[model samples]
Target: MKDAAKASGSKEQTADTTGDEGEAPAAKPKKRKDNKGKDAPHYSVKEPAGYYPILPVQVVPAAERPRVFAYASSTRRDFEVFNRYDLSQDLDFLILEIRQGSHSPFLLVLMYNQDAPDDTQQRGRSFERFKALALPDMPIVIAMDANEHHPLWEREKL
Candidate 1:
Protein backbone atom coordinates (compact mmCIF):
# COMPACT_ATOMS: atom_id res chain seq x y z
CA MET A 1 0.00 0.00 0.00
CA LYS A 2 2.84 2.49 0.75
CA ASP A 3 4.64 1.58 -2.46
CA ALA A 4 1.41 2.20 -4.42
CA ALA A 5 1.00 5.63 -2.74
CA LYS A 6 4.60 6.58 -3.57
CA ALA A 7 4.16 5.49 -7.16
CA SER A 8 0.92 7.53 -7.48
CA GLY A 9 2.58 10.62 -6.04
CA SER A 10 5.55 10.24 -8.38
CA LYS A 11 3.16 9.71 -11.33
CA GLU A 12 1.29 12.92 -10.45
CA GLN A 13 4.60 14.84 -10.23
CA THR A 14 5.76 13.38 -13.51
CA ALA A 15 2.48 14.26 -15.20
CA ASP A 16 2.63 17.89 -14.00
CA THR A 17 6.25 18.34 -15.09
CA THR A 18 5.73 16.63 -18.46
CA GLY A 19 2.63 18.72 -19.22
CA ASP A 20 4.58 21.95 -18.77
CA GLU A 21 7.80 20.77 -20.48
CA GLY A 22 6.57 21.09 -24.11
CA GLU A 23 4.59 24.33 -23.72
CA ALA A 24 6.25 27.54 -25.13
CA PRO A 25 6.54 30.55 -22.87
CA ALA A 26 3.56 32.93 -23.06
CA ALA A 27 4.46 36.08 -25.00
CA LYS A 28 3.39 39.59 -23.98
CA PRO A 29 0.65 40.98 -26.28
CA LYS A 30 1.59 44.15 -28.18
CA LYS A 31 -0.68 47.15 -27.64
CA ARG A 32 -1.41 49.44 -30.59
CA LYS A 33 -2.31 53.12 -29.99
CA ASP A 34 -3.96 55.44 -32.53
CA ASN A 35 -1.25 57.81 -33.80
CA LYS A 36 -3.43 60.13 -35.93
CA GLY A 37 -1.79 63.58 -35.79
CA LYS A 38 1.09 62.14 -33.79
CA ASP A 39 2.29 60.11 -36.81
CA ALA A 40 5.40 61.11 -38.78
CA PRO A 41 5.10 63.76 -41.52
CA HIS A 42 3.62 62.51 -44.78
CA TYR A 43 4.55 63.89 -48.25
CA SER A 44 1.95 64.57 -50.99
CA VAL A 45 3.25 62.80 -54.08
CA LYS A 46 2.68 64.35 -57.54
CA GLU A 47 1.20 62.14 -60.19
CA PRO A 48 3.07 61.43 -63.41
CA ALA A 49 2.48 63.65 -66.46
CA GLY A 50 -1.11 63.54 -67.80
CA TYR A 51 -2.13 61.31 -64.91
CA TYR A 52 -4.51 63.68 -63.12
CA PRO A 53 -7.35 63.49 -65.67
CA ILE A 54 -7.07 60.37 -67.79
CA LEU A 55 -7.81 60.69 -71.50
CA PRO A 56 -10.98 58.86 -72.46
CA VAL A 57 -9.44 57.49 -75.64
CA GLN A 58 -6.53 56.08 -73.68
CA VAL A 59 -8.85 54.04 -71.48
CA VAL A 60 -11.48 53.40 -74.17
CA PRO A 61 -10.36 51.48 -77.23
CA ALA A 62 -10.64 53.42 -80.47
CA ALA A 63 -12.21 50.43 -82.22
CA GLU A 64 -14.81 49.98 -79.51
CA ARG A 65 -17.90 51.50 -81.12
CA PRO A 66 -21.23 51.55 -79.32
CA ARG A 67 -24.29 50.67 -81.33
CA VAL A 68 -26.39 53.77 -82.01
CA PHE A 69 -29.69 54.33 -83.84
CA ALA A 70 -30.86 57.70 -85.11
CA TYR A 71 -34.57 58.45 -85.51
CA ALA A 72 -35.51 61.75 -87.09
CA SER A 73 -38.84 63.53 -87.31
CA SER A 74 -40.04 65.02 -90.62
CA THR A 75 -38.59 68.41 -89.69
CA ARG A 76 -35.27 66.68 -89.31
CA ARG A 77 -35.65 64.54 -92.43
CA ASP A 78 -32.81 66.48 -93.94
CA PHE A 79 -30.41 64.91 -91.49
CA GLU A 80 -31.58 61.43 -92.35
CA VAL A 81 -31.50 62.21 -96.07
CA PHE A 82 -28.01 63.59 -95.68
CA ASN A 83 -27.02 60.39 -93.92
CA ARG A 84 -27.52 58.44 -97.16
CA TYR A 85 -24.67 60.33 -98.80
CA ASP A 86 -21.14 58.93 -98.94
CA LEU A 87 -20.27 61.30 -96.12
CA SER A 88 -22.88 59.43 -94.08
CA GLN A 89 -21.34 56.03 -94.73
CA ASP A 90 -19.05 56.49 -91.77
CA LEU A 91 -22.06 57.11 -89.54
CA ASP A 92 -22.55 53.37 -89.15
CA PHE A 93 -19.59 53.43 -86.77
CA LEU A 94 -21.85 55.42 -84.49
CA ILE A 95 -24.77 52.96 -84.75
CA LEU A 96 -25.36 49.29 -84.23
CA GLU A 97 -26.91 47.05 -86.83
CA ILE A 98 -30.57 46.58 -85.99
CA ARG A 99 -31.67 42.95 -85.91
CA GLN A 100 -35.32 41.96 -86.16
CA GLY A 101 -36.83 40.64 -82.88
CA SER A 102 -33.46 41.42 -81.30
CA HIS A 103 -32.69 44.63 -79.46
CA SER A 104 -30.68 47.13 -81.45
CA PRO A 105 -27.00 47.11 -80.50
CA PHE A 106 -27.62 50.62 -79.29
CA LEU A 107 -30.36 53.14 -79.98
CA LEU A 108 -29.91 56.62 -81.39
CA VAL A 109 -33.23 58.39 -81.69
CA LEU A 110 -33.03 61.68 -83.54
CA MET A 111 -35.70 64.27 -82.79
CA TYR A 112 -36.27 66.47 -85.85
CA ASN A 113 -39.51 68.19 -84.97
CA GLN A 114 -39.72 71.90 -85.80
CA ASP A 115 -42.32 72.42 -83.09
CA ALA A 116 -43.14 68.91 -82.07
CA PRO A 117 -45.30 68.46 -78.99
CA ASP A 118 -44.37 65.97 -76.31
CA ASP A 119 -41.14 65.19 -78.10
CA THR A 120 -39.37 64.58 -74.82
CA GLN A 121 -42.00 61.97 -73.91
CA GLN A 122 -41.48 60.20 -77.21
CA ARG A 123 -37.73 60.26 -76.63
CA GLY A 124 -38.17 58.85 -73.14
CA ARG A 125 -40.36 56.03 -74.45
CA SER A 126 -37.80 55.13 -77.10
CA PHE A 127 -35.02 55.13 -74.50
CA GLU A 128 -37.06 52.87 -72.22
CA ARG A 129 -37.80 50.46 -75.04
CA PHE A 130 -34.11 50.15 -75.86
CA LYS A 131 -33.19 49.77 -72.21
CA ALA A 132 -35.68 46.92 -71.85
CA LEU A 133 -34.47 45.04 -74.93
CA ALA A 134 -30.80 45.96 -75.35
CA LEU A 135 -27.87 44.09 -73.86
CA PRO A 136 -26.90 45.34 -70.40
CA ASP A 137 -23.65 46.86 -71.66
CA MET A 138 -25.01 48.37 -74.87
CA PRO A 139 -24.72 52.15 -75.02
CA ILE A 140 -27.44 54.53 -76.32
CA VAL A 141 -26.76 57.92 -77.85
CA ILE A 142 -29.55 60.39 -78.65
CA ALA A 143 -28.69 62.93 -81.33
CA MET A 144 -31.11 65.80 -81.80
CA ASP A 145 -31.18 69.15 -83.49
CA ALA A 146 -30.66 72.09 -81.17
CA ASN A 147 -33.73 74.34 -81.35
CA GLU A 148 -34.71 74.91 -85.01
CA HIS A 149 -31.09 75.31 -86.11
CA HIS A 150 -28.84 72.63 -87.60
CA PRO A 151 -25.33 72.93 -86.25
CA LEU A 152 -23.81 70.99 -89.13
CA TRP A 153 -25.22 73.38 -91.67
CA GLU A 154 -23.71 76.44 -90.07
CA ARG A 155 -20.68 77.98 -91.84
CA GLU A 156 -17.44 78.06 -89.89
CA LYS A 157 -16.58 81.61 -88.68
CA LEU A 158 -12.94 80.94 -89.30
Candidate 2:
Protein backbone atom coordinates (compact mmCIF):
# COMPACT_ATOMS: atom_id res chain seq x y z
CA MET A 1 0.00 0.00 0.00
CA LYS A 2 2.86 2.37 0.80
CA ASP A 3 4.54 1.64 -2.50
CA ALA A 4 1.35 2.33 -4.39
CA ALA A 5 0.81 5.50 -2.42
CA LYS A 6 4.34 6.73 -3.09
CA ALA A 7 4.20 5.88 -6.76
CA SER A 8 1.14 8.10 -7.09
CA GLY A 9 2.62 10.70 -4.73
CA SER A 10 -0.24 10.74 -2.27
CA LYS A 11 -0.53 10.84 1.49
CA GLU A 12 0.48 7.60 3.19
CA GLN A 13 -1.86 5.66 5.44
CA THR A 14 -0.92 4.17 8.78
CA ALA A 15 -2.17 2.05 11.67
CA ASP A 16 -0.68 4.34 14.30
CA THR A 17 -2.69 5.98 17.05
CA THR A 18 -1.66 9.47 18.15
CA GLY A 19 -3.05 8.90 21.69
CA ASP A 20 -5.28 11.96 21.31
CA GLU A 21 -8.67 10.36 21.77
CA GLY A 22 -10.63 13.38 22.85
CA GLU A 23 -12.13 13.88 19.40
CA ALA A 24 -15.76 13.07 18.76
CA PRO A 25 -16.39 9.40 18.01
CA ALA A 26 -17.36 10.20 14.41
CA ALA A 27 -14.56 12.68 13.68
CA LYS A 28 -12.09 11.84 10.99
CA PRO A 29 -8.74 10.51 12.12
CA LYS A 30 -5.83 12.91 12.20
CA LYS A 31 -2.98 12.87 9.72
CA ARG A 32 0.65 13.29 10.69
CA LYS A 33 2.79 15.41 8.42
CA ASP A 34 6.47 15.12 7.68
CA ASN A 35 8.93 17.99 7.85
CA LYS A 36 8.31 18.73 4.20
CA GLY A 37 4.61 19.14 5.10
CA LYS A 38 3.76 15.95 3.21
CA ASP A 39 1.91 13.26 5.12
CA ALA A 40 4.36 10.61 6.22
CA PRO A 41 3.83 6.91 6.33
CA HIS A 42 3.33 5.42 9.73
CA TYR A 43 6.61 4.57 11.42
CA SER A 44 7.23 1.28 13.22
CA VAL A 45 9.81 0.24 15.81
CA LYS A 46 8.81 -3.37 16.40
CA GLU A 47 10.82 -6.24 15.00
CA PRO A 48 11.85 -9.54 16.68
CA ALA A 49 10.82 -8.04 20.00
CA GLY A 50 7.21 -8.44 21.13
CA TYR A 51 7.61 -5.83 23.85
CA TYR A 52 5.99 -3.39 21.39
CA PRO A 53 5.32 -4.91 17.95
CA ILE A 54 6.74 -6.98 15.11
CA LEU A 55 8.47 -4.80 12.55
CA PRO A 56 8.61 -4.75 8.81
CA VAL A 57 11.20 -7.47 8.45
CA GLN A 58 14.23 -8.48 6.54
CA VAL A 59 13.67 -12.19 6.06
CA VAL A 60 16.66 -14.49 6.45
CA PRO A 61 15.14 -17.45 4.71
CA ALA A 62 17.23 -20.43 5.73
CA ALA A 63 20.21 -21.28 3.57
CA GLU A 64 19.23 -24.95 3.93
CA ARG A 65 15.78 -26.51 4.02
CA PRO A 66 13.79 -27.92 7.01
CA ARG A 67 14.12 -24.65 8.89
CA VAL A 68 10.81 -23.40 10.24
CA PHE A 69 9.78 -20.71 12.73
CA ALA A 70 6.33 -20.72 14.25
CA TYR A 71 4.41 -19.19 17.11
CA ALA A 72 1.62 -20.99 18.94
CA SER A 73 -0.17 -18.96 21.56
CA SER A 74 -3.07 -21.35 22.01
CA THR A 75 -3.68 -25.03 22.80
CA ARG A 76 -5.12 -25.84 19.38
CA ARG A 77 -2.59 -26.34 16.62
CA ASP A 78 -4.08 -24.90 13.40
CA PHE A 79 -1.07 -24.28 11.19
CA GLU A 80 0.99 -27.06 9.64
CA VAL A 81 3.98 -26.63 7.44
CA PHE A 82 3.72 -27.74 3.83
CA ASN A 83 6.90 -26.23 2.46
CA ARG A 84 9.13 -23.14 2.45
CA TYR A 85 10.71 -21.56 -0.61
CA ASP A 86 13.30 -18.93 -1.29
CA LEU A 87 13.57 -17.92 -4.94
CA SER A 88 17.22 -18.64 -5.60
CA GLN A 89 16.94 -19.25 -1.83
CA ASP A 90 16.22 -15.55 -1.46
CA LEU A 91 13.28 -15.58 0.99
CA ASP A 92 10.64 -15.97 -1.71
CA PHE A 93 7.80 -17.37 0.37
CA LEU A 94 6.35 -20.05 2.69
CA ILE A 95 3.43 -22.40 2.09
CA LEU A 96 1.33 -23.89 4.87
CA GLU A 97 -1.19 -26.64 4.24
CA ILE A 98 -3.29 -26.15 7.32
CA ARG A 99 -4.89 -29.50 8.14
CA GLN A 100 -6.58 -30.02 11.45
CA GLY A 101 -7.93 -33.57 11.49
CA SER A 102 -11.64 -32.72 11.68
CA HIS A 103 -11.65 -29.83 9.20
CA SER A 104 -10.91 -29.34 5.53
CA PRO A 105 -7.36 -28.22 4.91
CA PHE A 106 -6.40 -24.92 3.29
CA LEU A 107 -3.19 -23.24 2.20
CA LEU A 108 -1.83 -20.17 3.97
CA VAL A 109 1.14 -18.07 3.01
CA LEU A 110 3.06 -15.48 5.01
CA MET A 111 5.11 -13.40 2.62
CA TYR A 112 6.90 -10.05 2.38
CA ASN A 113 9.54 -8.81 0.00
CA GLN A 114 11.85 -5.81 0.23
CA ASP A 115 12.66 -6.00 -3.45
CA ALA A 116 11.88 -3.11 -5.72
CA PRO A 117 9.07 -3.82 -8.15
CA ASP A 118 11.43 -3.42 -11.10
CA ASP A 119 14.94 -3.98 -9.74
CA THR A 120 15.13 -7.55 -10.99
CA GLN A 121 18.83 -7.37 -11.73
CA GLN A 122 19.79 -5.81 -8.40
CA ARG A 123 19.54 -9.11 -6.54
CA GLY A 124 20.30 -11.28 -9.57
CA ARG A 125 16.59 -12.01 -9.67
CA SER A 126 13.86 -12.17 -12.28
CA PHE A 127 10.19 -13.07 -12.66
CA GLU A 128 11.22 -16.43 -14.10
CA ARG A 129 12.37 -17.51 -10.65
CA PHE A 130 9.00 -16.52 -9.20
CA LYS A 131 7.16 -18.47 -11.92
CA ALA A 132 8.49 -21.77 -10.59
CA LEU A 133 6.38 -21.32 -7.45
CA ALA A 134 3.17 -20.34 -9.21
CA LEU A 135 1.21 -23.42 -8.30
CA PRO A 136 -1.62 -24.01 -10.77
CA ASP A 137 -3.53 -25.15 -7.68
CA MET A 138 -3.12 -22.18 -5.35
CA PRO A 139 -3.39 -18.39 -5.56
CA ILE A 140 -0.31 -16.27 -4.82
CA VAL A 141 -0.22 -12.98 -2.94
CA ILE A 142 2.74 -10.62 -3.15
CA ALA A 143 3.54 -7.12 -1.93
CA MET A 144 6.95 -5.50 -2.49
CA ASP A 145 8.42 -2.07 -1.89
CA ALA A 146 10.00 -0.02 -4.66
CA ASN A 147 11.86 2.97 -3.41
CA GLU A 148 13.67 5.17 -5.89
CA HIS A 149 15.12 7.04 -2.91
CA HIS A 150 14.22 7.13 0.75
CA PRO A 151 16.41 7.18 3.85
CA LEU A 152 14.33 4.83 6.00
CA TRP A 153 14.12 2.21 3.26
CA GLU A 154 16.40 -0.83 3.53
CA ARG A 155 16.80 -1.63 -0.18
CA GLU A 156 20.54 -1.99 -0.75
CA LYS A 157 22.15 1.38 -1.44
CA LEU A 158 23.59 0.15 -4.67
Candidate 3:
Protein backbone atom coordinates (compact mmCIF):
# COMPACT_ATOMS: atom_id res chain seq x y z
CA MET A 1 0.00 0.00 0.00
CA LYS A 2 2.89 2.38 0.73
CA ASP A 3 4.43 1.88 -2.68
CA ALA A 4 1.12 2.30 -4.44
CA ALA A 5 0.09 5.47 -2.63
CA LYS A 6 3.60 6.94 -2.98
CA ALA A 7 3.88 6.17 -6.65
CA SER A 8 4.40 9.46 -8.48
CA GLY A 9 1.72 8.76 -11.02
CA SER A 10 -1.38 8.67 -8.81
CA LYS A 11 -2.58 12.23 -8.39
CA GLU A 12 -5.46 12.39 -5.91
CA GLN A 13 -6.95 10.06 -3.34
CA THR A 14 -10.66 9.52 -3.41
CA ALA A 15 -10.81 8.53 0.22
CA ASP A 16 -10.29 11.43 2.62
CA THR A 17 -10.20 11.77 6.38
CA THR A 18 -13.96 11.62 6.07
CA GLY A 19 -15.19 8.12 5.32
CA ASP A 20 -18.93 7.40 5.74
CA GLU A 21 -19.72 10.71 7.41
CA GLY A 22 -20.02 13.82 5.31
CA GLU A 23 -18.79 17.28 6.34
CA ALA A 24 -20.08 17.94 9.83
CA PRO A 25 -17.78 20.25 11.75
CA ALA A 26 -14.35 21.76 11.65
CA ALA A 27 -11.85 19.29 13.13
CA LYS A 28 -9.74 20.34 16.08
CA PRO A 29 -6.02 19.65 16.22
CA LYS A 30 -5.55 16.77 18.69
CA LYS A 31 -2.97 17.50 21.34
CA ARG A 32 -1.06 15.08 23.53
CA LYS A 33 -0.28 16.13 27.12
CA ASP A 34 2.77 13.87 27.03
CA ASN A 35 4.23 15.64 24.01
CA LYS A 36 5.72 18.56 25.89
CA GLY A 37 8.42 20.16 23.71
CA LYS A 38 8.72 16.98 21.71
CA ASP A 39 9.29 17.05 17.95
CA ALA A 40 6.45 14.57 17.33
CA PRO A 41 3.85 16.18 15.13
CA HIS A 42 0.22 16.34 16.26
CA TYR A 43 -1.57 14.99 13.22
CA SER A 44 -4.58 16.93 12.00
CA VAL A 45 -7.65 15.27 10.56
CA LYS A 46 -7.44 17.67 7.66
CA GLU A 47 -3.81 17.27 6.64
CA PRO A 48 -1.85 14.76 8.65
CA ALA A 49 1.86 15.34 8.04
CA GLY A 50 3.51 12.93 10.46
CA TYR A 51 0.80 10.76 12.05
CA TYR A 52 -2.30 8.90 10.92
CA PRO A 53 -5.62 9.65 12.64
CA ILE A 54 -7.36 6.31 13.27
CA LEU A 55 -10.97 7.12 13.88
CA PRO A 56 -13.41 9.60 12.43
CA VAL A 57 -12.36 8.98 8.85
CA GLN A 58 -14.40 11.33 6.72
CA VAL A 59 -15.18 10.81 3.01
CA VAL A 60 -13.95 14.08 1.63
CA PRO A 61 -11.31 14.12 -1.08
CA ALA A 62 -7.80 13.58 0.18
CA ALA A 63 -5.33 16.42 -0.24
CA GLU A 64 -2.98 13.95 -1.89
CA ARG A 65 -2.82 10.38 -3.02
CA PRO A 66 -3.47 8.50 0.20
CA ARG A 67 -2.42 4.97 1.11
CA VAL A 68 -5.42 2.77 1.82
CA PHE A 69 -5.58 -0.69 3.46
CA ALA A 70 -8.75 -2.55 4.39
CA TYR A 71 -9.71 -5.96 5.81
CA ALA A 72 -13.15 -7.33 5.23
CA SER A 73 -15.00 -10.15 6.92
CA SER A 74 -15.73 -11.58 3.54
CA THR A 75 -13.78 -11.38 0.32
CA ARG A 76 -15.09 -8.87 -2.13
CA ARG A 77 -14.33 -8.38 -5.79
CA ASP A 78 -13.85 -4.67 -5.31
CA PHE A 79 -10.48 -4.40 -3.55
CA GLU A 80 -8.52 -6.85 -5.65
CA VAL A 81 -6.50 -4.04 -7.20
CA PHE A 82 -4.50 -3.48 -4.04
CA ASN A 83 -1.96 -5.97 -2.79
CA ARG A 84 -3.23 -8.24 -0.07
CA TYR A 85 -1.18 -9.76 2.71
CA ASP A 86 -2.41 -13.06 4.11
CA LEU A 87 -0.37 -13.20 7.28
CA SER A 88 -3.54 -13.93 9.26
CA GLN A 89 -5.91 -14.99 6.57
CA ASP A 90 -8.48 -16.01 9.15
CA LEU A 91 -8.48 -12.61 10.83
CA ASP A 92 -10.28 -9.59 9.50
CA PHE A 93 -7.46 -7.07 9.74
CA LEU A 94 -5.45 -5.05 7.28
CA ILE A 95 -2.61 -2.56 7.45
CA LEU A 96 -1.45 0.30 5.29
CA GLU A 97 1.67 2.44 5.37
CA ILE A 98 1.43 6.11 4.50
CA ARG A 99 4.24 8.60 3.99
CA GLN A 100 3.84 12.28 3.38
CA GLY A 101 6.31 14.39 1.47
CA SER A 102 9.58 14.10 3.41
CA HIS A 103 7.76 12.97 6.54
CA SER A 104 8.34 9.75 8.42
CA PRO A 105 6.13 6.84 7.45
CA PHE A 106 3.23 5.78 9.70
CA LEU A 107 0.93 2.76 9.78
CA LEU A 108 -2.85 2.50 9.66
CA VAL A 109 -4.53 -0.69 10.81
CA LEU A 110 -8.19 -1.43 10.27
CA MET A 111 -9.92 -4.33 11.99
CA TYR A 112 -13.25 -5.90 12.86
CA ASN A 113 -14.12 -7.94 15.90
CA GLN A 114 -17.06 -9.82 17.32
CA ASP A 115 -19.35 -8.11 19.81
CA ALA A 116 -19.40 -10.85 22.42
CA PRO A 117 -17.29 -10.39 25.55
CA ASP A 118 -15.85 -13.84 24.95
CA ASP A 119 -14.20 -12.42 21.84
CA THR A 120 -11.91 -10.16 23.86
CA GLN A 121 -9.19 -12.78 23.79
CA GLN A 122 -9.07 -12.67 20.02
CA ARG A 123 -8.98 -8.90 20.07
CA GLY A 124 -6.09 -8.94 22.49
CA ARG A 125 -4.16 -11.31 20.29
CA SER A 126 -4.78 -9.10 17.28
CA PHE A 127 -3.50 -6.09 19.18
CA GLU A 128 -0.38 -8.02 20.11
CA ARG A 129 0.26 -8.69 16.45
CA PHE A 130 -0.16 -5.02 15.65
CA LYS A 131 2.25 -4.03 18.39
CA ALA A 132 4.83 -6.46 17.11
CA LEU A 133 4.75 -4.94 13.63
CA ALA A 134 4.85 -1.33 14.77
CA LEU A 135 8.12 0.58 14.88
CA PRO A 136 9.22 2.28 18.09
CA ASP A 137 9.30 5.70 16.46
CA MET A 138 6.63 5.27 13.84
CA PRO A 139 3.16 6.53 14.65
CA ILE A 140 0.25 4.09 14.37
CA VAL A 141 -3.48 4.42 13.95
CA ILE A 142 -5.97 1.60 14.50
CA ALA A 143 -9.50 1.82 13.21
CA MET A 144 -11.85 -0.82 14.51
CA ASP A 145 -15.53 -1.59 14.09
CA ALA A 146 -16.03 -3.50 17.28
CA ASN A 147 -19.59 -3.61 18.52
CA GLU A 148 -18.64 -5.04 21.89
CA HIS A 149 -19.38 -3.12 25.08
CA HIS A 150 -16.23 -2.34 27.00
CA PRO A 151 -14.93 0.18 29.53
CA LEU A 152 -11.69 0.83 27.66
CA TRP A 153 -13.36 3.12 25.17
CA GLU A 154 -16.49 3.76 27.20
CA ARG A 155 -17.34 4.42 30.82
CA GLU A 156 -20.67 4.02 32.60
CA LYS A 157 -22.25 7.18 33.92
CA LEU A 158 -21.96 7.74 37.62
Candidate 4:
Protein backbone atom coordinates (compact mmCIF):
# COMPACT_ATOMS: atom_id res chain seq x y z
CA MET A 1 0.00 0.00 0.00
CA LYS A 2 2.87 2.35 0.78
CA ASP A 3 4.31 1.61 -2.61
CA ALA A 4 0.92 2.34 -4.19
CA ALA A 5 0.78 5.60 -2.25
CA LYS A 6 4.10 6.75 -3.66
CA ALA A 7 3.08 5.62 -7.14
CA SER A 8 -0.21 7.56 -6.90
CA GLY A 9 1.54 10.75 -5.54
CA SER A 10 0.05 10.46 -2.04
CA LYS A 11 2.24 12.29 0.47
CA GLU A 12 3.02 11.45 4.09
CA GLN A 13 3.59 15.07 5.12
CA THR A 14 1.24 17.40 6.99
CA ALA A 15 0.03 20.83 5.89
CA ASP A 16 1.38 23.89 7.68
CA THR A 17 -1.33 26.10 9.22
CA THR A 18 0.41 27.58 12.24
CA GLY A 19 -0.12 31.22 13.17
CA ASP A 20 -0.33 33.73 16.02
CA GLU A 21 -2.46 33.40 19.17
CA GLY A 22 -5.57 35.33 18.20
CA GLU A 23 -7.58 33.87 15.32
CA ALA A 24 -7.68 36.16 12.29
CA PRO A 25 -10.87 36.95 10.42
CA ALA A 26 -11.79 34.33 7.85
CA ALA A 27 -11.29 35.59 4.28
CA LYS A 28 -13.91 35.13 1.60
CA PRO A 29 -13.35 32.38 -0.90
CA LYS A 30 -11.50 34.04 -3.76
CA LYS A 31 -12.00 33.18 -7.39
CA ARG A 32 -8.80 32.00 -9.04
CA LYS A 33 -7.40 34.52 -11.50
CA ASP A 34 -6.05 33.72 -14.91
CA ASN A 35 -2.34 32.89 -14.76
CA LYS A 36 -1.75 34.17 -18.33
CA GLY A 37 -0.61 30.73 -19.54
CA LYS A 38 1.66 30.05 -16.58
CA ASP A 39 1.32 26.78 -14.70
CA ALA A 40 -0.69 26.88 -11.50
CA PRO A 41 0.34 25.22 -8.28
CA HIS A 42 -0.83 21.65 -8.06
CA TYR A 43 -3.36 20.79 -5.39
CA SER A 44 -1.77 18.36 -2.94
CA VAL A 45 -3.12 16.30 -0.05
CA LYS A 46 -1.48 14.97 3.06
CA GLU A 47 -2.67 11.76 4.63
CA PRO A 48 -3.73 12.55 8.17
CA ALA A 49 -2.90 10.43 11.19
CA GLY A 50 -4.36 6.87 11.29
CA TYR A 51 -5.04 6.73 7.58
CA TYR A 52 -7.02 3.64 6.61
CA PRO A 53 -6.44 1.73 3.39
CA ILE A 54 -9.31 0.32 1.36
CA LEU A 55 -8.29 -2.41 -0.99
CA PRO A 56 -10.11 -3.77 -4.08
CA VAL A 57 -10.74 -0.28 -5.44
CA GLN A 58 -9.60 -1.55 -8.84
CA VAL A 59 -12.05 -4.41 -8.66
CA VAL A 60 -14.74 -2.01 -9.87
CA PRO A 61 -14.93 -0.91 -13.48
CA ALA A 62 -12.49 1.85 -14.45
CA ALA A 63 -15.29 4.26 -15.38
CA GLU A 64 -17.33 3.36 -12.27
CA ARG A 65 -14.48 3.04 -9.79
CA PRO A 66 -14.45 4.87 -6.48
CA ARG A 67 -12.81 8.24 -6.91
CA VAL A 68 -13.72 10.77 -4.23
CA PHE A 69 -12.83 10.23 -0.59
CA ALA A 70 -13.38 13.04 1.90
CA TYR A 71 -10.40 13.92 4.06
CA ALA A 72 -9.66 16.70 6.50
CA SER A 73 -6.89 19.22 6.14
CA SER A 74 -5.49 20.71 9.34
CA THR A 75 -5.23 24.08 7.63
CA ARG A 76 -8.87 24.30 6.55
CA ARG A 77 -10.49 24.05 9.97
CA ASP A 78 -13.55 25.91 8.67
CA PHE A 79 -14.55 23.08 6.31
CA GLU A 80 -16.82 20.30 7.58
CA VAL A 81 -17.99 17.01 6.12
CA PHE A 82 -21.73 16.83 6.73
CA ASN A 83 -23.33 13.75 5.19
CA ARG A 84 -22.55 10.68 3.08
CA TYR A 85 -24.95 8.92 0.70
CA ASP A 86 -24.26 5.37 -0.48
CA LEU A 87 -26.53 4.53 -3.42
CA SER A 88 -25.35 1.18 -4.70
CA GLN A 89 -22.40 -1.22 -4.85
CA ASP A 90 -22.74 -2.05 -8.55
CA LEU A 91 -23.05 1.57 -9.64
CA ASP A 92 -19.97 3.44 -8.45
CA PHE A 93 -21.28 6.74 -7.14
CA LEU A 94 -20.80 8.73 -3.94
CA ILE A 95 -22.65 11.76 -2.61
CA LEU A 96 -21.49 13.98 0.24
CA GLU A 97 -21.71 17.52 1.48
CA ILE A 98 -19.02 19.91 2.63
CA ARG A 99 -19.76 23.19 4.30
CA GLN A 100 -17.47 26.18 4.41
CA GLY A 101 -17.84 29.55 6.11
CA SER A 102 -21.37 30.87 6.75
CA HIS A 103 -22.67 29.93 3.32
CA SER A 104 -25.31 27.26 2.59
CA PRO A 105 -23.87 23.76 2.29
CA PHE A 106 -23.82 22.04 -1.12
CA LEU A 107 -23.92 18.43 -2.28
CA LEU A 108 -20.90 17.01 -4.09
CA VAL A 109 -21.59 13.97 -6.22
CA LEU A 110 -18.82 11.92 -7.80
CA MET A 111 -20.12 9.66 -10.53
CA TYR A 112 -18.99 7.52 -13.44
CA ASN A 113 -21.36 5.90 -15.88
CA GLN A 114 -20.81 3.29 -18.52
CA ASP A 115 -22.55 4.03 -21.81
CA ALA A 116 -23.78 0.50 -22.31
CA PRO A 117 -27.42 -0.33 -23.07
CA ASP A 118 -27.56 -2.95 -20.30
CA ASP A 119 -26.61 -0.35 -17.65
CA THR A 120 -29.58 1.92 -18.49
CA GLN A 121 -31.99 0.52 -15.91
CA GLN A 122 -29.44 0.52 -13.07
CA ARG A 123 -28.43 4.05 -13.97
CA GLY A 124 -32.04 5.16 -14.07
CA ARG A 125 -32.74 3.73 -10.60
CA SER A 126 -29.58 5.33 -9.22
CA PHE A 127 -30.52 8.74 -10.58
CA GLU A 128 -34.06 8.39 -9.15
CA ARG A 129 -32.58 7.73 -5.70
CA PHE A 130 -30.21 10.65 -6.14
CA LYS A 131 -33.08 13.02 -6.94
CA ALA A 132 -35.00 11.80 -3.88
CA LEU A 133 -32.03 12.51 -1.60
CA ALA A 134 -31.50 16.07 -2.85
CA LEU A 135 -32.97 18.97 -0.89
CA PRO A 136 -35.06 21.57 -2.68
CA ASP A 137 -33.37 24.89 -3.55
CA MET A 138 -29.93 23.62 -2.53
CA PRO A 139 -26.74 23.79 -4.60
CA ILE A 140 -25.56 20.48 -6.08
CA VAL A 141 -22.58 19.71 -8.26
CA ILE A 142 -22.34 16.46 -10.18
CA ALA A 143 -18.78 15.67 -11.19
CA MET A 144 -19.05 12.77 -13.56
CA ASP A 145 -17.22 10.84 -16.27
CA ALA A 146 -19.90 9.85 -18.76
CA ASN A 147 -19.22 7.96 -21.96
CA GLU A 148 -22.18 9.38 -23.79
CA HIS A 149 -21.77 10.30 -27.46
CA HIS A 150 -24.39 12.83 -28.41
CA PRO A 151 -24.80 15.61 -30.94
CA LEU A 152 -25.83 18.00 -28.17
CA TRP A 153 -22.40 17.68 -26.58
CA GLU A 154 -20.74 17.83 -30.02
CA ARG A 155 -19.71 14.20 -29.74
CA GLU A 156 -20.86 12.61 -32.97
CA LYS A 157 -18.83 9.44 -32.56
CA LEU A 158 -18.49 6.99 -29.72
Candidate 3 C-alpha lDDT tens digits along 35-79:
355322223234244333322122222222222334322233323
lDDT of 1 by residue, 1-158 (tens): 01122333432111001123243322224322223532111111233443221111111212222132233233322222112111111211222222223444443434322321262332333333333443335455656443455667688832
Q: CA lDDT of 132 in candidate 3? A: 53
- Give all TM-scores, in the order shown: 0.18, 0.30, 0.32, 0.41
Model 1 residue 151 CA deviation (Å) reads 15
How does each model score on lDDT?
A: 0.27, 0.34, 0.39, 0.42
User: Which residue pairs collide in model 4, if any?
Assistant: none
Q: CA lDDT of 103 in candidate 1?
A: 44
Model 3: which residue pairs collide?
17-57, 17-58, 18-57, 18-58, 18-59, 19-57, 19-58, 19-59
**Candidate 2 positional error at 45, Å:** 16
For candidate 1, report its TM-score: 0.18
CA shift of 111, model 2, Å: 1.4
Kindly indicate the candidate among 1 and 2 with the higher TM-score. 2
- What ordering of candidates by TM-score runs from best to worst? 4, 3, 2, 1
In terms of TM-score, the best-performing candidate is 4
- Clash count for candidate 3 is 8
Error of 1 at 123 (Å): 12
Query: How many backbone overlaps does candidate 1 show?
Result: 4
